[model samples]
Target: MAVTDLNPSDNDQSFRCTGALTIGRAGSTQRELDAMPDGMTIDLAGVDRMDTVGAWLIHRTQRDRGAHIVGESAAVKALLEQVAAADHPVQVRPDLRPAPTRALAELGTWTVEVGQTLFGLLGFFGATLVGFGNVIRRPKRFRMNAVVSSFDAVGVRALGIIGLMSFLIGVVIGQQGAVQLQQFGAEVYTINLIGRLTVRELGPLMTAIMVAGRSGSAFAAQIGTMKITEEIDAMRTIGVSPVEALVVPRMLATVLMMPLLSFFSMLTAIIGGGVFCWVSLKITPATYAMRISEVVPLHDLDVGLIKSLVFGFIIALGGCFQGMLVEGNSEEVGRRTTNAVVQSIFMVIVLDAVFAVFFSSIGWL
Candidate 1:
């Protein structure tokens, strides 16, 4: 590289820059340029090669010192123009907003997302009903094998855990109810408390929660993987309805199993409460059974069965809906699976409240 003064004066001085003007000599070149006064002429006619770094340095010197660039080839002129065009102010710091404003914006976004999801779920449910209708019209299209497989998976495999959970919950309820009743010398009514609570609420509710966490997540993960793998698309290509082949069978299995599981949960819970009474309250099994039969109404059992059926429907709907919505990579399978469980459990609780209000209004409570 070489620099020579062409015409020197207190104002309007000129200098010629030659050789390769690039990153290698950018530091020295910048220092040399800084020594020159502003409003000078920079001659690039002798520059053999000028890259982006060189252009940036020259452009900066020209802007800061009011230097005029002159005498450049086409390529150098274009490169300099591009570098100059790219210069602009850019914001570096993050934009901060007031806390309340940020919170309101987040709330609005959440509300919109929830509305969209709800709309999509409703559409999916309608498609499921259409699939069910088609199967009903053509009985042979029903997949009995898939339904049986789902039954074994969702119902039979779940019995041990459901029973254990129910037993523990019953023991807790019995122990706590006894403690409270003992304060009023009404320990004998512990049977009524346990029997009524188990049959009317806890048994079916707990079973639904367990099913949402277990079978619901499984449904979403399985179907989501299928969606990601394009298996659902393949089914459609082969003239198979995904809803009929995949979703309906699983939903039917869940709906059929819920009432049975709820009943099993109820009996196990009652037995657990009875066991606790026998051990701690000096009550015999025979007396416990007699009291349970006398105090717990048949209507209470009906309430549990009804709730179980609805809960089963909602759980299957949420799982299958989330699964059908899956797209993109394998990570979507995990996200949809979690969404299935959360949506199912949340919907179940909301519907449970609705049912309670409805039943109470109708004098069934």
Candidate 2:
């Protein structure tokens, strides 16, 4: 074992090494001395035993700092040569790359799986349509308790959130309308604008969104759990159609409650808009009511009720489809539940847009 300090120039800079450069102790020493000034080299000839680590340190030091190793013994040089080879191993090309046909085949398989899932959804909807006949023939067999529970879950539990959201929406609509009407000295008309918009569009749309988040996800998770736990299969074995026992009841519940929820939402939003008009627009409640009476027709409220009924069906159908598709385990239940909510909400929005276009084209607006 030996140690040396080499100075490259008159500057206060040098390299130092101590003891034999073996694999066990070389790593720490290399790290310590690797940060020296340029052109400093540590001699290694006195090193008696050397291994891969010692060789790697020398190789790295030379590569990084342009340092040269001097006075290396045969054993040290042999080890250094092996480390250099290992550090910079020769690259070898594969005998053959993946063929274009193979890539295409893999892509085709993935596309087919996606297509199958979509077709499965279509099949489920078709089956439910057919199952409706069965439900009608034996209506007494349907679980009324479960249906009422689903109704309460979708409608009653959602009232607070829907009411608060509708009120805020109403306030925004009133403020926006008031700004434009105030410019024309017709600020009282803000109530008409807010009422018509809320009853004809926003009320049903907002209520559907609330139910999509609340009841839609619950339906998917409940049915998905049943599927995973073999409860769906048990129901089938006991002469109960899963569609009627689970899905039909939920769908009916949603359809029954959606219009009621929409009506409640419309009332709240109208009240909220009136409040905003009274405070900010300096319009009295009586004047606002008179304006709303003159502008908003009964048909606008009817359109909202019809849209809520349609949106409710869509939400429940989406949720039930995803739930019936759930397989494998608990994770599948969660995955399908999330899919149910997203798909239901998207469907609700798309249908709302379609309704808007249809109604506008028919001069309903």
lDDT: which candidate is best? Answer: 1
Residue 250 miss distance in model 1 (angstroms) = 1.2
TM-scores, in order shown? Answer: 0.86, 0.68
Which pairs of residues have clashing backbones in candidate 2?
none
Question: The CA-based lDDT of model 1 is what?
Answer: 0.93
Off by more than 4 A, model 2: 1-118
Question: If candidate 2 were superposed on the true structure by all CA atoms, what would the RMSD be?
Answer: 10.7
Query: Cα deviation in Å at residue 154, candidate 2?
Result: 1.3
Candidate 1 lDDT, 24-56, residue by residue in tens: 988988888877787878899999999999999
* Backbone clashes in model 1: 0
